[model samples]
Target: MTAAIRLATARVGDLAAVMRVMDAAFEPAYGEAWSGAQLLTLFALPSARVCLAWDGEQVCGFSAARIAGPESELLLLAVDPRFRGRGIGALLMKDWQAWAAGEGADDYFLEMRADNDAVHLYEQSGFSECGRRPAYYRGNDGMVRDAITMRRSRDRDGED
Candidate 1:
């Protein structure tokens, strides 16, 4: 199943498909999903990049990031629930890091709800916990969750 998945640069026409994947991937209680308009705003940024993963004709995953000088932030990443565990998330992370590096980014950052299991995937991709905000995310159910910030520095001749 993983073999059939392909990653490509996201096009404006792919917005709807990306939204569908976002809807399926994010649990409503977490209030983590971004609106289509918000995503479109990212598309207008010169430094922003969005990648989409497709399985046949279906959009299964996506990742969005933006770079500023030597720093880059991963704004969003999601894989459809039906496509989880097939390495799509890892693929997205790898692609984002490469894209950022190519765009002159040396430090990469991402923040997520502390309880998110995707932390494991980010860690595997070389991101480590760098900071945290207590009770940062207020969920739809009025429950708060910590937001953890993770960072990965490109190894420049063994120096981070």
Candidate 2:
């Protein structure tokens, strides 16, 4: 039997699950250096929108966004290590896009470390590189790193 895939809203109680997925998907080299407390702050942000993918009791993947004015910025996306290759990331992204569209967002954006392989994922989701911030990220290597900014806009006909 195939495992059921479910999407649900994330709650204050789900911070630990979200952190678990993030820590597993992003090692010290990739994550934002955010402690658990910092992540909790994200849960508290007024503009925050978070969603999680579940396979029964396990959290398979998650995504978050923060909307400001006309732009919705994807803040985090991670799939559990055990469930990485089954299109869970894409599922989470689709959910996020739906939420942003419901919020009347006209544009969506995200920033990733220049070396992050997930840039390809964003591209596959229709985001295009619009700008870059050099030396924008502080790496574990004790050097600054660049970040690539990507964007996707809603068509005037209201399509992504």
State which candidate has the highest TM-score: 1
Q: Give model 2's TM-score versus the native structure.
A: 0.91
TM-score of each: 0.95, 0.91
- The sequence of per-residue lDDT tens digits that candidate 1 reaches over residues 67-95 is 99999999999999988999999899988
RMSD (Cα, Å) of candidate 1?
Answer: 1.7
* Clashing residue pairs found in predicted model 1: none
- Per-model C-alpha lDDT, please? 0.92, 0.83
